[model samples]
Every structure is written in C-alpha cells, then in structure tokens.
Target: MSGLPAFRPEALEQWLPRTLQNHYVDLLLRRIGMTRRRADCFVRLALYLFLKNCQSRKELPKPPLTELSFPQGWVECSCLEAADVFYSDRDRGGDRAAGMMLNKLVDLGLIQKQFDGNCTQVKFHAMPDLLKSDAKNLHISFAIDAFDPRSDAIPIANLLANNYNWLNRNNDAVTYRIANILRDWASQYTAGLRVLRRSDNQNPVGFYAFYPTKRESEVKFFEPPSRGLHLSQVADVDPFQMALAGDETCRSLFVRSWVIDSDYRQAAQMELLLDAQQTMKKMQQDFPNLWDMYTLIIHPSYAELSLALGFQKTNADPKMPLYWMYQAVDRFLKLDMQNLMRDAQSLN
Candidate 1:
C-alpha cells in the first residue's frame, strides 16, 4: 500500500491551480477515491471533451462525458441515448456504466442536476470559494449561471475561485490577484467547471452564507419492484438497522445543515444525526423495499465529534478533507452515553 491515500481524478485537480486545461485529469483521480487505471480514462475523456467542446466522442451520452464537446469532424450523431450507452456498458454494472464516468464530477461538487423531468438536462454550476471580508461588509456570493451550451469554455479563474474558496484567504488582495492569473491560464488550457465568489471588504470574518451543491443519483430505495421483497424480510428493523442492510434503494437519503444560534453547533449536529437515523429507521420499519440508509459526510471540522458518537468512517481520501461515515441505526440507539462522554475528551 502506498503511504499517500488514493484520490479520484477530480479530487486531484482541487490540489492544482484553479484554472488550467486538463484540470479534470487531476480531479478524476480524486473522484474515484482510489488509485486505479480508470483514472487515466477520466483524463482522456476530459481531453476529448476539451478539444471537441463535447463530453463524448460519438455524441452519445454514453460514458456520460462532462468536460468536453464532440469533434466537428465526426458525422453521425450516434442518436444513442444515455440509457443505451448505459446498457451497452452493462458489464461495468448499469449504475457504473450509465453514471460512473460523470459521478466523480458530481461527488467533487463540480456538476449537479438541474432536475428537469425525464429529458435529462443536467446543468453545471461553477463558483469559487472566495469570501471577501472587510470592516463594513462581506461579499460571499458566487457568479451564478456561468455555463452556457453555446460557449466553448468557462473562464479558468472564474471556475476555480468559484467552486473552491479555500484558495482565497480572507482579505489578501495579492493572493486573489495571483489566483486570477492562474485562472486565466487554466481557462485557456483546460475544460472543467468552477465555483466563484466575491466579497466586499478587504478583510472580513465570520458567518458568510454559501450554497454548496449536492450529488443526486437516479437510484432511490422506495422505488417499485424491490421494495416489496425487502420490506417483508426486515419489517421490524430499526432505522439504523435498516441503513446497515445495504440495499440500492436505501441510498437516496438527502442531508443538509440547519441554521441555529451560535451556541447550538454541537447540540444541533447531534440532533440532526439522530433525526437522520430515525428517518431511515422509520422507512425500514414501514417500507418493505428499503434496506440500508444513505448518509452524507459530516463537515470536516465537526467530524471528530461524530466519530465519538460511534460513526465509523466509510471513506478515506486525503484530498477530500471531508469524509462519509456510518453505523447501524439500531446499534446507534443502544450506544452507551458514558462512552460518548468519555470520547468527547478529544474535543476539549
């Protein structure tokens, strides 16, 4: 095993400059969240899309390429839909075939579904993590709707700074300007999306609002067919128990943070975790098709607290900084309060 943990290609790009052609190659490595040859394929796909301004070579959504368009020299439209592309690659597994190539982008927060019914129109949002702070005001909003179908590419500075704010340090003008130059070079060379932001004050602090994107998969647990089969087998399981069953349908749980007073961070997070487990357990007890519950990663800064609560890490990647963790829903309820209190020492 290598000393350095593996990263997906998309995650790798996050480490490099914000604006650079072939940014996806590095990111692709990060997205797979592992070291593998397929990461190379991700890079090639990025290159192909960069040159053609299309995501796929054959004009087919198959392999669902995101960064580039297709070559003008190509004649046939392939007329093939994403479903066909998925089925054709069924050996890779339907989910992997239809969605694997693009899943990394979603996981990295580079792309998201606009959620139009059935026709499958995916809109990409690029924003920088930049938060401008000053004595008077803080500008913490992204340049929205930057991606256009007709445009050949997005500005590198805009994409990098847009999606990633960790690059921006409070009110440092020099770093921000240098970041712009790097963005320009990336726009000219690479083909990937970014998140953008701009703040008013030169140096500001505390409480900037942000809208981070979430990944959506077509796979949902409550859907027909399998629901009936699984519901009967696990009728009495607790939400935590159901989540551990590990069925495809259980993967659709959506998680988001709720705003509360400053003093409530610890309490609020705990409550939310409990609610999420209860929600999954409810579905498990009431719904037949549901199996395992899907959970989101806790924010990195808060992870130590979650671990103390008995959440086991399911993902490991240095580039991600954040991680997703899980525990049996039923097991969660039986956790000893004393143990939780003892482990809480880490926070002190």
Candidate 2:
C-alpha cells in the first residue's frame, strides 16, 4: 500500500481535484442522492474502499454481474483508518464520525459493513447503473397513482414480508408479522399510493398507505400510549374513531406505511416527495379536513427519511429503538423538499 492510496487524508486529497468533479459526484447524486458537499465527503470514502478493495481482488473468483454489483470489492480496515479516509483531521474526531458514516452508508445500501473485533469488514455494492440510456434525465423516473388494494395487495404483502432491502435494516420477522397485520387491516387505509417502474414493466415498485382519523384518536399518536402502539400493535380505527363528517374541515392522517423499493428510493424520493405534496393538496380538496400526519417507525432508513422530512420523534419510548414520528400538513408544504433532500444523502 506504499505507492497507492493508503486510507490517509493526504492520499485522498491528491485525487479530489480531478476525479471528485465527474465520476464520484454524478454517481453520488444519481445513485446515492446527496448535496455536493456531502457527496464529496462520501465519495472520498467510497474511492478509498473501492481502490483498496480492487488491490485485494486479484485472486478472488468474481461473482455474476447484476444491477447493484461491484466488479471488484471488499476491504477490512480499522475504524480510525476509515475515519481518516472520510474526514480530514481538522473536522473528524477519531472513530466516532467514522462509525456514524459507516452506519449511514449501510442504511443507504451503498456498502455493507460488519464489525470484526477492533476493525470493520466492508463490502462495496455499486448502486445500479440502469439509467445509462437517459443518464441526463433528472426527472422522476417512476410513475405514481392511487394504490389499488385489489391488484397491489399481494405485492404490498410480499414487500412487507419478503423485501430483503427493508427487512435487513429492520428485523425480518417483525416486518413479516407487520405485513400480515397490514393485509388484515387493508380496509382501514383511507388513502393509498403506489409506485410503478417506467416503460412496460407495470409491476408495483412501492406504496404509501394512510388512515384518516378524528382528533380524539389522533391525540394517542402524538402522546405515548400506555400500551404503546408500535407498528406491530397498531389496530384499525373503528367507525366511531373516524372524524365527524364535515363539508370541508381539517382532519388528521395516520401514515400506515411508506414503502418504496430500495432501488427506486435513491432517485425517486425527491419526485415522490413532490408528488406527496400534491397528493395532500388533492386530499385536502376532497376531504377538506386533512389536518396532520403521524406514524410509528421501526425501519432505520425510513426513520432517517422521516426525520429529514421534518417528522419529530415524540416521547414514545426512550428504551426502544423505535418510536412515533409526527409532521403537520402545513409544515410539509412549507418545506423546500428539493433543497431538503439534496443534503439528505446521509438521512436517505
């Protein structure tokens, strides 16, 4: 490692002027979705792992190629060394920042890391390069429409139970149970939205399900319930729990689920957020009583995303790794989502 990049700040600085502008930045924005500055930080670490991993892949049998494949990868390094690669000495504090970035990268599906004694084993999974034909197209690449429970239920059930992408972050078993319960309570969903891939493949890629409720019931979501209404313990809002009929009054929304394919989320989130904003407008137009939205989050990636979108974690449970998150309709509308998401690579 003498002549090559050796996980040092100076070593990485040498290539930044040339490589960071093109290859690294574009991929981080297109594949990982980050602000230029944050992408710059992530790219440095990515380059170090990628190049060093390449040096070690000389004899290993290459795996079959696919969408999110890296031709040469995997490296084991001390947390301190990774810290040096990600942040300069002036800004980084030993291994703490390194650990945070590593967790974020793993959550983003950029790299998979496992702790091994004092060091970490890192495996690079290149984000899919399927956008080559229209590489310059920055528009939302997927389509969205009202989620049809009849056709999308099975797919939603499958995603909730079987998607390796989400299950990896949250436990596989927890989601499997959640999937079944979500299916059983499908009728409880007041509004649902589904995502579709571009071109001819019409299979559903993701969905966002919601439950509208009256203020009396909405209070439990903002406050910690004694029984603790985690996603696993959530129940349907009975007819009495429904908000009173109004010609055009404000009502609250309980987010049942916001599941998007891991592949589609990195690129489509901004557009989807914009779509959601419009959807709220339409919902308010129809319901006239659309108030605020809230939900319990167990998935780490979704938690980070909900945080970035301005969802505040209520005093639900300090001991638990999960809790309820809340956001008002007006607050979401007031947000500059495009700007908020640019630097949200870490949160995403």
Candidate 3:
C-alpha cells in the first residue's frame, strides 16, 4: 500500500500507453509485422500492465530501443495468477488468450520469462519500480561509438548492474554477459562495429549492439529470439554479406541490432541512427559487395522505425509476431539525415 498509487482512471490517464487509444499506434505497430487485431491486443495488454504498475505505485520503465537507458528487469508472479490478471474477461479459470500474447511478446523481444519449477517469473522489456528521482535532474547522457571492452568494460558493467537486479551481481557475471555479447557480435560477416555508450564520457548506459554477417550465415544460424537468449537474439540481426561457401560470391548483410532508442523520439533518434549508419556506410567503402540488411526486431518501435528506414518484411504474416526484415544498401544511403545531432539536455 505504501509504494502503490491510488487506482483512479482519469488520474492515471497520463501513464497509459498510446496503443490503448491511438489507432495510429496499432497502424505503426503493424509495420513491424503484427496484424491490426494482434497490435490492438498488445496495446490493450500494455495499457492494462501500465495500470497495474500504477496500482502498485511502480515507476515507468524507459521506452524500448529509443528511450532505453537500462533494462530494470521484470515483475515476478506465478503463471496462473499472471494469466488470470492479464485476461480479465476470464472466469475463475482463464482462457488461453494470455498464453498466445505471451508467445507473441516473446517473439517480439518485448518481454522475458523464467521458469522456477514452482512459479514463473516475468520480466517486461520495460516496466518499473518508478525512478526515485526525476530523469530531468539525473544529468546522465550517452554517446554511441564502436565498443571497446578494454576501456569501457568496468563502467558499462556498473551501469548494467545498477539497473538490472537479476544480473549475477558480481564482476564475473558482468564479464560473462560481455562475453555473450561478443559471441553474438562475432556472427557478423561484413565490415561492422560493435556499439557501446559513453555516459558523460565516463559511464555506459544502454547497448545498441550492431554486427555484420553474410545472408547464408544468417539463414544457417538465425534463431528466433523466442527460442534462445533475448540479448543474443535482439542484436542478432545482420544486414548484408559477401562471398559464398565455394566458387560463389554473395552480396548481403545481416544486422543483429538495428536498435534505435525511440524514447528520444525523432530528432535525437536520428542522431543515434547516424552513428550506426556512418559505420555501415563506411563498411561499403572497402567492401563494395555489401547489399541487403536483415534483422528480427527486438522492440515494437523497431518495427516501424525499420520500415521508415526502408526495410520490408520477409515471410511476414500480420497475424504472427515473428518477422525478418530486409533493406538494400543503395536505398538506405538515400535517406535525408540533415538533423543528426542531439541536445545535451536529453541525457537527463
């Protein structure tokens, strides 16, 4: 009761996700591969969860990809109880609607679940205990760059530790996570750079992992995020590639992470996008064989964002959540990027 907020609809209106009331939200969500119905369902659920967070007096998690600062982890509850709550139309016994939503959300990289043999734990991609202080007063900001673990490891580890309590809470655990990131990044076959952040040039905030790979490699190793580790699968998409197995050359690239923190919204986001864009743009200089780009989007924002960047879904079904997208390098370079720098105030 102490940490929770009063449940008043109008009073809590500000906290609701746009998807609940905005038809445009679902329309945008559809660009990432959801059918209109599924998108509507997801937004309703998102709004429901937001209300729950308020009833519990929890803070809002940062927006996915764009507003991403840190992954604070999930809310823990039994599967049965969660299902009942998620689908309010249920009788004393809930129907399977919750399960279907769970599968789709997992496929989209929006949430994570862990089974404890007794009860299941759920971690929303962005949900919270509320920020104790105003983000405006925090005075923290990030600059993305080619990741260098040697110089950037400690601060980055500390940043991850501060927000994600589910982490092992030790130096070794952070190291292990870094190792996993490297393994995922290694799959890229094209010329690419691993992205990291420098917070005020001292700390690290979020990971917008980027990798390079061949199309054949992606088809061979591309695993749906719902089936494996989220971090691995989130940035697991590579854009293009070059050279085939034997006596054959190929031109395609797969991007493991084309993450753009949309919380920053248009202007700020384009700046971040340019950082990665420049890297990919440079990859073209030495390796002219580069062409297509591919990714299994991690966040719903990424779906439309990718679409805006000139990507098209491959084997996409509106009724289904899972999707792989492709874009040609020739077209990507054509986007106007006149506004490519962000105001320092957003760091707060």
Q: Could you estimate the TM-score for every candidate?
A: 0.27, 0.72, 0.47
Candidate 3 global lDDT: 0.47
Candidate 3 lDDT over 206-261, as tens digits, reads 44444444445556334443332233223344323334222123455555544323
Q: Could you tell me how far off, in angstroms, the CA of residue 232 lies in candidate 1 after the best superposition?
A: 38
Clashes of 3: 29
User: Against the true structure, whose TM-score is highest?
Assistant: 2
lDDT of 3 at 218: 51
TM-score of 1: 0.27
Ordering by lDDT: 2, 3, 1
| Counted clashes in each candidate structure | 64, 5, 29
Best by lDDT: 2
Find the 10 residues in a row with the least total lDDT in model 2: 60-69
lDDT of 2 by residue, 229-278 (tens): 43443344332244433524437777766766665666566667787787
Candidate with the larger TM-score of 1 and 2: 2
Cα RMSDs, all models? 20.9, 5.6, 10.7
Task: Compare candidates 1 and 3 on TM-score and give the better one.
Answer: 3
Q: Residues 58-114, candidate 1, lDDT per residue (tens digit)?
A: 333333333333233322111122223223324443433445545544443433433
Show model 2 residue runs off by greater than 4 Å: 1-9, 12-17, 30-33, 54-74, 88-93, 126-141, 162-190, 194-199, 223-250, 285-287, 339-348
